[model samples]
Target chain A: MTDEKDFLSGYDPGDFPAFAVTADVVLLTMRAGRLCVLLIERGGPPFKGMWAFPGGFVKLDENLDQAASRELQEETGISGIDLTQFASYGDPDRDPRMRVVTVSYLAVVPDLPSPQASTDAAKARFWPVDDVEGTLAFDHDRILGDALSHLRTVVEYSPLAASFCEREFTVADLRRVYESIWGVDLDPSNFQRKVLGIDDFLVPTDRQSSSSAGGGRPARLYRLGKVSELRPPILPPD
Target chain B: MTDEKDFLSGYDPGDFPAFAVTADVVLLTMRAGRLCVLLIERGGPPFKGMWAFPGGFVKLDENLDQAASRELQEETGISGIDLTQFASYGDPDRDPRMRVVTVSYLAVVPDLPSPQASTDAAKARFWPVDDVEGTLAFDHDRILGDALSHLRTVVEYSPLAASFCEREFTVADLRRVYESIWGVDLDPSNFQRKVLGIDDFLVPTDRQSSSSAGGGRPARLYRLGKVSELRPPILPPD
Candidate 1:
């Protein structure tokens, strides 16, 4: 082994180029029977006025997750939400001003309230996943595409789809979450059979949803189950 | 919307601190019915002579995946293997030299030859996963734990376990891969039933392994099947 002194002789911390690190989040939710993503209109350079995921540079004092949460709160007024670190983007030319590497995070909210943009963003709004226009700021289009794919994959094996629903929801509500995200129509009975067959997928409550003025039968309400992963995973229709 | 010039006036590229990015690979393989991880002895400062994953700084020219593959080849003399980017670690104090954020990759090989250390690594060898001593350099211990958990989870849902076996293997060979990684003994009949039950889990070939001198029947050889994911995923025994 080389001695510390010998190693130090050849090593210089300043020799290598340093990179700027940023945390960007792709926040998604289900609203009005469709999947929506929170996008901010860039108020600053590089891609001014263009839509982008709310994000910012990582501070020296905070860790990556903390940076993600802080940026989400500072820019969009959304706080205390769970974020999953999905992927890191570091193309040499990703940022024009400098060499920047962005760590991307994914957040699934249960119908979050509207967001008010501040701190470098001119506007913030939830755009239906299909309604997202042209290109997003930076390489965010790629990042958002990856995040959506990650969500679709995890929803099959894990009970993550429940995160998009209210505390207590009917089986149809859960089915819609799948349908909207997968962009496919599913048979009601087949969906219900597959959902209920998975053990620990739902905890049924005695109370049922109130019948609408049309006078149809009420659907039973259920809470998210104990297990994080679903057995006999609810695969999307082919 | 803010004008590009006005946004540029307020933003300075040098205002935020820069970070050094690194790519570390956790290479795992099954040998002699034991789960082993590839480790290299560090030749330089902070943790000189300590065992660590083969890694180094990410170059300015390459993408994250390319950097990971390059680093693995440079330090350990292993190349052309598939790597999965599992997680990134960026605790402010992870590296003592400077603020370094490491993107970790996991590679599962099928009984490869021994590795020869080069560049900054003094020695390279496979260490049984359970036999890793003390603390590894930097936050590698936590990184390894996360990688192991990722492996365990994916083994249930994906055909990832097959990556640890030879191209042509028997049902017992595949089962041993699980038992070794999960560190549990499984009932042979039950294991065979579950594995065969999963559609597209294995493709049977027209050949079988030669019978042992102990006079046992030759087991049929099979290759990995068409599907990437398993339906009704093989759950680990309780």
Candidate 2:
């Protein structure tokens, strides 16, 4: 056996540990009345070839938001999507070889598109919330859970739920976004009143859906309103 | 003259790149009639002897919350307070020595005795939200601003505001917590209807205040309800 002191002395650096900081993107979009997130394949060692959230090591000079935006654009080939910082993760064993802390961001896109891998990855694809079956790399499973909870909470008081809808969507369309994410069937009449009553929550548009799935007087389409308050806040399911 | 390789090779043994992580405590409590935060004095190097939010380094194998709690307990003799992870800060140059990432926590307490110094060379004290006069050390001022905004948003929908009041309180007393934090006078009738209509926001108690400040009937006292939802959420001032 090798001498213990020799081995220990060889490994000792005697300085404060260096940690690699990175940003991960949880780009969310509504697809088929469900929430979907973009996932990327890792090409590098240390969880190589496993599905992971889109992210990269933050550069020395970039801010956290800028790093997140850059990673999103590079990994997903999408730009100009509104991204909000969600949470940060820093478990010592999160990365096996090094200490890595990742700041997670939530991006709500208007439409779902096939993602192209741009950085250190094998491939990029959009996975439906229902289809995210297996374990995700790193501590991403926890991060996604936190992001979803934040999204549901935000939708109650803020107009962010509208971001998941198209430029001009009917009230029913808006309600679907809430119902799917919250996993609750809303009272149609009450939902209509609650959404329309909020001034900034939606804005009436001079547009209507070409496809009349719910036959009647063609439903009038409205965009996200300018008013922010949802007078009577939307309560989550008991 | 030192060569490039030699210059790089002369890494200081004491100056190893340490993962600089900070713990910021959003110590919140109701003072007089408004919400306030606790601040502390720094007695260590690298901003030695400056006033800052009470926090410290994250030990290996500990989660961020554990670190925050440990710091809170060490700095102040307080323990078992309800604390929530609020946000994380990871600016490259937030610390002078190296890149420091901070996980900030929001803690709610019901008027405890003043905090005593427990860890580091620091003194702990409480300050009102409106009285954060000048710049705080290490971008703490920005962190405080974000924490306040989060508190405002959280109090509107969550049952957190009641944490500031006693176990049993009046509708008027609860309303004052909102008014004090938001810094605006609320219409008693509208406020009462909004809070009472919500199921379980507050529970009716058989006890009433024995002495009224003025004439009129002694208003009924009620304990915080089991239900957490503030149905028609109390909105912040425009």
Candidate 3:
């Protein structure tokens, strides 16, 4: 007790190196049959003019999730999207300005309107996940890869793929969501059978597609399921 | 670009409130047919004497995962445990000393030797998950709840439940691990059917438990299979 009291009496936070925390967001949405990630063109030094996830320093008052939402809203003028804190990155040399540890958030939504850039971003847009040309600023390239991998896994077990569809969609539409994100051509009948086999995975509506795009039969429409997770997940092809 | 340049020119990490980062670990293991978590007694003021997860400030040179492992070893004298970064905690007033953000890791293993406390921890021991008496120091109570929920879910889809058992175990031993952690009574025959249905979930071994405590036929022992995930997750009873 005497040794502990003595140590506590002289304990100082200043003894440790200063750490700055930031929240970065990897916002994903389906656009034109492709998975796209929201990126910003940095307008200042420290990877200026390079692309990176929409993010900024976490404020003193707000929590990490709030900081991530605020950064997304401030930089891209897009808000009201549900965000999940997926992972945190804290490599000592990740940021040049200081020892910055970033908590990364992930959000996947249906297609969104074009982003309006502000703050330290020269421009904001959703780039196809596979089409990003060069390295992202900082360790964002790694963060993006992690977020994508996480997204791929979750969609298999959760109703997250429905998040990319409209309120009511046909089996083909849902299959396309899996195909675009997983980057695999799944047999239409097989995909439908797998998804339908999962109890409560889909709620069939008493309607069909207005236009018979195939000129044979209008696909049956369905809504999101009552349950959140998919038992017997629809596994992608090898 | 001009506005961004001006903002960057005056950007100083020092301007924001000083922040500290730490790593905490939730060490879980099966003991006496119960799930237990390793906790340490704080030796200093501000919740002194309260039991909390083994943790300390993260060093400048180490990454979050490395920091978590180091803290677990430094405080509890336990090493070689596999740790997964489950979540991060960064409420503004979580720590009275300063604005501290903590990355929390979770580890489950076969029973370990009794812990020996050091560093700022006055004592260390494994407490049954159901028997944690008082509120844990800081936001650890919430962190513990989250870690438990995550453990329960992962065990259903992944081969993590086997982590609590010996290298080779019987179907009954494996069932006990899930039943203990999930707090449920599972029918033995039904449980065996569910597990065996999963492809590559359990590999049959040529040995059986020598002592058939039940004066009956000895149960066959098996090891973990090659597949990491279970395609059709064994959902807990509603």
Candidate 4:
């Protein structure tokens, strides 16, 4: 073959462009009735004092998912939660230093303790999507937008949205998750009917609870049912 | 930074691992009312004589899409067809010679002339998805399965399945595309109603055609309409 990196030829594995692979996380949670992403302030020279998503180069010996978990644990002291990759950004020029292809994941959690910034980050904090003012480091702004769109698409058709709620949750908690992320006001009756209608959408349990703030009617507790996808899928607001 | 490839340092771009990026295509069409993919037999070492998806390493300059189009043109003499990437596969062991991550695209066309194999391929032909016997070279079997799953998922919620039909087609043509790809027997009446019910799923034109096999009533002609997505999506068979 004319090229040295040919799959047929026993060429040096290092002949590849060797683009540094990185994982950028769009860690989201419903904070104060809004969707927030965990971000960091760069403490290093390239983008000193600038904000960016918590991410790092993928290690040579690990899978991209493993690299993501490792980066989260190393940078934000947050791990063990589910992280679904939504998109991979690799516009040759996306990274200034070299050809860096970053796979971005969207993570929605029920609770998160205050993060302790490590590695090259000076500080770490959760920034509400709307309140995330100013520019983000590299192409993180576009990556965040892509992740949010993917999240919106995923929540509309998949059961992963329930992962944002407590193990035992009322319908209100599920409704709130959709409302917060979708930024819409869904009629509760219609939403519940649509969710329950999906085959195995939710499994009703014996546990019940009422809001601590007021003694409202006791709500049924349910777990994420056997269904991984919704049918007559949830349509986005027109 | 302790690591040489650290993004924070604004270091030399050359220090990154520079893994090779490639693109594979899953070109599908309806032949005798069955969905088939275009594949090639490798003529060179390492998987020589094995059937594989048409692909090549990305050039130093062109984007992934460009590279895919170029490869298809070079190997099969097919060009200008719209090919959308469905998934990207990257595992260190996926490729034997080097770490090559591939973005796989899926293209659906109404008809295709016999392929002219060039480059490293010894032969090229269309293989029905249901009849693809033996193992495909590399990780293509998994990639094709992923693309088919994605295609099934897309047709349920989007109108892209019409891409497999001629520019002007009848309702039966559109129905066959879905049925062939999904491997389901959709009720004609139900399929027609569901398709027409979706807002702007089809735009009727003045053209008409009758089946050559029988002297049947002429069927009305229609084209892809403005609606990009289907609400209350068409669910798959149980």
Best of the candidates, lDDT:
1
Better of 1 and 2 by TM-score: 1
Give me the displacement of residue B146 in model 3, in angstroms.
Answer: 0.6
lDDT of 1 at B77: 67
- Candidate with more favorable, higher DockQ: 2 or 3: 3
Better of 1 and 4 by DockQ: 1
Q: Is candidate 1 or 3 superior in TM-score?
A: 1
Lowest summed lDDT over 10 consecutive residues: which window, candidate 4 chain B? B1-10
Can you give the lDDT of residue A119 in candidate 1? 42
Q: Residue B165: error of model 1 in Å? A: 1.8
Tell the DockQ for candidate 3.
0.42
lDDT of 3: 0.80
Q: For each prediction, how big is the interface RMSD?
A: 5.4, 12.5, 4.8, 4.1
Order of models, best lDDT first: 1, 3, 4, 2
Please give the distance, in angstroms, between residue B190's alpha carbon in candidate 1 and its true position after superposition. Answer: 4.4
Worst 10 residues of 2 chain A by lDDT: A1-10
Local accuracy by lDDT, each model: 0.81, 0.72, 0.80, 0.76
Off by over 4 Å in 4: A1-16, A115-122, B1-12, B114-122
lDDT tens string, model 1, A70-126? 888776667887799999989888878878888899998888654553444546788
Off by over 4 Å in 1: A1-10, A115-122, A193-201, A213-215, B1-10, B115-122, B193-201, B212-215
DockQ of each candidate's interface versus the true one? Answer: 0.43, 0.18, 0.42, 0.40
- DockQ score for candidate 2: 0.18
| Model 3 regions lying over 4 Å from their true place | A1-10, A115-122, A193-208, A212-217, B1-10, B115-122, B193-206, B212-216
